[model samples]
Target chain A: MRPALRPIVTLAPLAIVLLGLFGGGLLLGLLQSVGLFALTGSDAFTLSHYRALLNDREFLVSLALSVWVASLATAVSLLLGVTMATALHYGSFVGASRTRWQRTLLQVPLAMPHLSLALVVLHLLSPSGMLSRVAYALGLAPEPSAFPVLVQDAASVGILLAYVWKEAPFLAVVALTMLTRVSRDFDDAARTLGATRWQMWRRVHLPLVAPGLVSASLAVFAYVFGAYEVPLLLGRTYPAMLGVLAERRFSSVDLIDRPAALALALAMSLIAAMLVWVYLRLARQLVGERPVLF
Target chain B: MTSDSASPVILRGVSAAYGDTPVLRKVSLEIDAGELVALLGPSGCGKTTALKVIAGLLAPSEGEVYFGAENVTPLPAERRRAPMVFQKALLFPHLTVAENVAFPLDVQRIPTHQKKLRVAEALALVRLGDFGARLPRELSGGQEQRVALARAIVSAPRVMLLDEPFSALDETLRGQLRLLVREVQQRLGITTVFVTHDQREAATMSSRIALVLDGGIAQVGPARDFFTKPESLAVARFFGWQVLHGANGNWLAFRAEQARLIAPGGDAPPEGWLVLPAKHLFTTDLGTQRLARLRLAAGDEVEVEGPLPYVAPDAAVALALDPGCIREFPADAPATARGW
Candidate 1:
């Protein structure tokens, strides 16, 4: 084989599997959503499914809910993750054994599956769950019924909490990796330049960690936006997350609603792609024109 | 821009450790106001740690640091205002050169116009006036270090710390930067503490050299004193002095250049010169001069450098030492004499 072609040939098998599985499924979904490749009806391309979604208030409400949940979850996770990583990095002076224990504890959340985490969130935040019971037992509340509705509510607080709990540790690991790669001398330099602790965070730590944080946040946001099981287990019935709504339509008894479901899935993908673009642009500004995405 | 007249820095009986491993042990030194002192030592000898202690970047386990009359041991690095230039340029990669130079002022929240003026003045001081708009990545290694220097002094710090700031550069660039640093230090008259392992760099750049050995200061004095009057055998050895044991627990030390070789069976009638018998082991050509290696009768190996002495291998020779060049230390003397 030619030298230049060797790398291509070596990579071809993995590329084939990824493109065939993911790309092929996406292409099929796109065709079905546009009214072509229909399983039962005439396979003719049309935009009626997407047009119907634009006019449907239920779909619009679900879309807005998904955006709201995902945005809040991602923003809170990123903030907490960056703060946690910075604390761990600087707190290393507290002694190696304690720092090691702290780091190990942070990874405990990352080890559990998201489904298990969502269930855990349900058990902890439900009206009659451990927290409400404890609150009542401590005389902070009159009873479990008096506890605020957190799960299966219009606010989607349960789903957002689950996402943050599951994803913040992952983001912290990402940001920590970048933090360790940055030399401690930079911090020393900043300190010697008379930067207070807050100024160090704003000027040095933030910019240095932004690229990794942004990349990891894009992943978290996209995953939370389109995830199905957590929202299904925790979200409100009246106005569901986009993922739950799409799954409901796809699984409905009527076959005619399939195109609308596929269209909703495609819309979720479009929104994720647009968000990734915006994140990449913001990452460029934060990291000083260094190519972050590529 | 002139800083507040420089404050004398003093580290009194400071000791520090990393985990359980002690890095600096009761190291003490004092610098006059406007004096430049180099903390000189071999690698891992705690010179840099001492510099960090003075800069307030590392808290000493014991003892106090003072800036003039103020006890600053409790102050953090940010409040100390002793800016340090590191071995690597360590310029903030995200900021342009001007922003990096202006960073100290920005941290102090100096007004915009004064910040701009000082940044420009610092860049010009480092001879990088036109390069302010470029990022750190765009500058060469030497230029990056220059920018780091500019950033260090831009705040008009009363004292500066430099930790091997030019060791990464090539010899030519190192020489250029050494001169540049010395020039700027003298021009500003800031009390500066520089850390370095290179003797020549320390000698060339610092008004005084503090020789650190193990975790303690061996000796601190004028550069010429280190060469002529080392206080201990260890200090003499560190400066490449050939030491010989003498009677009554005395140690004689002299440099390689101070020894002269005389032909075997030659005259030995010098009044004050000390002479030892030796065998020529070999000769090494050092371009400008040739070094003749010899083993003395007492089993100590020493090298003498001069125009090629006609001594064949295994040929017996007499080594004569100038009494003026010899320093004596007691055999029981500690490795570091602290009071010196």
Candidate 2:
């Protein structure tokens, strides 16, 4: 084999899997959404499914809820993750063993599956859960019924909580890796150059870590936007997340709703792709010809 | 650029450590205003740690650092205003060269026009004026270091600390940068502490060389004194002096250039010279001269630099040392004498 072709050949397995499974599924879904590949024997290609989705208030509400939940979750996670990462990094200087334990504890949520984490969030934040019981025991609440409705609420607070809990640590791990790669000399240099701690963070550290944080937050945003299980377990029934709404339509008893479900999925994919393009452009502007992501 | 008149820096009984391992112990030195002092030592001898203490990057466990008459040890590095250049350029990669040089002024909230003017002057000082708009990655290694030097002096700091700033460069670049640093330092008259393991670098750059050993200063004096009047046997050996045992348990130290090889039965040696019987071991040919290694009768090897003698290997010869060049120390003298 030619040397140049060797790398292509070596990468063939990954390419085949990605194109065959993900690409093929996406192509099929797109065709079905446009009204082809109908089980009812009508093979007409039409935009009726997307047009119906655009006009439907239920679908619009679901779309808005998904956008709201994902954006809030990602923003909260990025902020918390950066804070946690910085704390762990500087905390190591005070006590290495304590920081090590805290780092290990952070990893516990990351190790569990998202569905399992949803259950954990449910047990902690539900009306009759541990927090409510403690509130009642302290007489802050008259009973479990008096506790605020956190789970299965219109705000999707439970789903957002679960995502922030699961994704913050994931983002923290990414930020920490970038932090460790940054030389300590940069900090010392900033200090000697008369930068206070906050100024050092704003000028030196934040820019240095922004690319990694943006990349990780993009991943979390994309994942939380499409995930269904958490919303199914913790969301309101009236206005569900796009993922849960699409899944309900896909599994409906009527065969005619399938195209709308596929349309919703394609819409989600389009939003994610556009977001990724914007993020890539922003990252390019940040680092200036350096490779931010491969 | 308007250079601030430099202030004297003093470290009094400064001791520091990394974690539990102590790096500097009761290390103290006083640098006069506008003087360049080199903390000269081998690797891991705590020279860099001492420099860090002075820069306020590392707090000394014990001792006070004073800038002129003010006790500055309690202040943080940001408040101290003593900038340091590290071994690597360590320019902020994200910022342009001009912005990196303007960082100190930006932190201190200097006026925008003044910051730009000072940054331009600093760049011109380091001969990097045109490269200000470029990023650090666009510059070569030597250029990056020059930008770092520009950044260090841009604020017209009263004191500057350099930790082996040119060590990572090629020899030619190192030589150029050493001269550049010395010229800039002299022109600005900033009190500077330069840390280097290279004795030649120390001798070439510093007004006084402080020889640090075992986490303490063994001696601190003018470069010439390190050779002519080393206080201890260790200080003499460190400066490449050839030490030999003399009669009555005395140790004699002399530079290789101070000793000469004499053929047997040659003219009578000059008065007040110490002559020892030796056998030629071998000769190393340098471009300008040959260095002949000879074994003295007392079983210690010594080098004499000159044109190689006509004698072959193992040929008997007499080595004559000038009494003026030889520093005699009693056998019981301390290996490392404390204080300056």
DockQ of each: 0.81, 0.87
Residues A99-139, candidate 2: write the lDDT tens digits.
Answer: 99889989999989999989988898899888999999999
Docking class of 2: high
Residues B93-178 of candidate 1: C-alpha lDDT, one tens digit per residue = 88899999999999999999999999999999899999989989899999999999999998878799999998888999999999
Q: By lDDT, who's the top model here? A: 2
Off by over 4 Å in 2: A279-291, B264-268, B334-340
Q: Could you tell me which 10 consecutive residues in candidate 1 chain A have the lowest summed lDDT?
A: A285-294
Each candidate's lDDT (Cα)? 0.87, 0.88
State the lDDT at B76 in candidate 2.
Answer: 94
Q: What TM-score does chain B get in every candidate?
A: 0.95, 0.95
For model 1, residues A122-160, the per-residue Cα lDDT tens digits are 898899898899899999999977888899987888998
Q: Give the CA lDDT, 0 to 100, for residue A64 in model 2.
A: 84
